[model samples]
Target: MMTANPYSFRKVALGDLDLLMAWQSSPHVQKWWGAQEPYTAADLADPRVARWIVSYDARPFGFMQDYSVHGWENHHFAHLPKGARGIDQFIGDPDMIGVGHGPAFIRTRLQALFDAGAPVIATDPHPDNAQAIAAYKKLGFEPSGPAQETRWGLILPMLLRP
Candidate 1:
C-alpha cells in the first residue's frame, strides 16, 4: 500500500517575506507562476488568505497559499459552497523541483484543509502549465470546466472534493 507523505507546513510570517520574495522571483517558480509584481505585506496579511511554508524532512522547500473561494473578491469560484477553498503553490528549490514531491505535498495540504472543514479545494493553473495540471490531477483534482479569465490571466479551473 502507498504510504502517507511526510511533508510539514508552517504558517507564514512577516519574517518569511524575503524568502518568499526570492522564490517568487526565481526563474523556476516564475516561469509557471508568473510573479508580475513583488508580493506585498498587505497581500500576505490578507484575512482571506492562508499562506504556509512547505517543508520536507524538516527543510523548507516551497510555499503554498489558500483562500476561501466564497470570500474572495470577484472570485470565479464565488459560487462554490462556504467551505470551498482555492490554493496556489510552487517548489522554490531547484534541486527539489521534480522528483515526485509535488503530488505528495499537495495531497498533504488537501488533507489538512479537509480536516479543517473544507469539503472542496480548487486551483487554477495557466492553460499552458501542463506539468502543474498533471500534478494536480495526480492528487485527485479534475477540471471543473472551461478556461476562465482572471486578473492574473487565463487559467483552467480544477477542483478536488475531499
Candidate 2:
C-alpha cells in the first residue's frame, strides 16, 4: 500500500491547511494550478470541501480536491456532468516538484474513478499552462478540441475505464 505504483488517497487535516494554501498561492505553482480566489482559512475550514492528502512512496506529497462532487458551477468544476468526478491537485511540498510522480498519480486516480463508475473524467486548465497540458496528453488525455478563449473551454478528455 505504501508503494508509489498503487497510489492511495487520504483525507487532509487542519494541520495541513497552511501548507496547502502556501502551495495554492505560490508563484511557482500558479502556472500549473488554476487561479482560484484566495481561499480563506475559514474556507479551508469547510467540512464540505472534503480535502485529501496525496502520497507517493508512503510520503505525503500534495493535495487533491473532488469538486465534481459539489461546489459552485460557474467557477469550479462543479458543472461537470453528474456521475463525472472532477479532480484538482498539486504537489504542495516544494521539494517534490519534477519528481516524476504526477502523471502516475493522476493515472491511478483516474483508474480508481473509472472503476467506481465514472464514464468520463474531464479537466479544464489554462490553455497556456503548457507543461500541465503536455503531461495530461502523455497520460492519454486528448483534447475535445474545443476552446472558449477563457481558461476553461479548454476541455481535456480522459477515458476512465473500458
lDDT of 1 by residue, 13-94 (tens): 8898888888888898988877657667798788888999999998999999999887757888887888899999999888
lDDT score of residue 32 within candidate 2: 63
Weakest ten-residue segment in model 1 by summed lDDT: 32-41
Off by over 4 Å in 2: 1-6, 32-50, 69-81, 149-162
Estimate, for each residue in 1-162, the C-alpha lDDT of model 2 and write its tens digit: 563474678877667766676777877676666565665668666754546788876788777775454454454444555676666677777787786777878777778778888767766656676766777787777665554454354444332322
Best by lDDT: 1
Error of 2 at 40 (Å): 6.1
RMSD of 2: 3.9
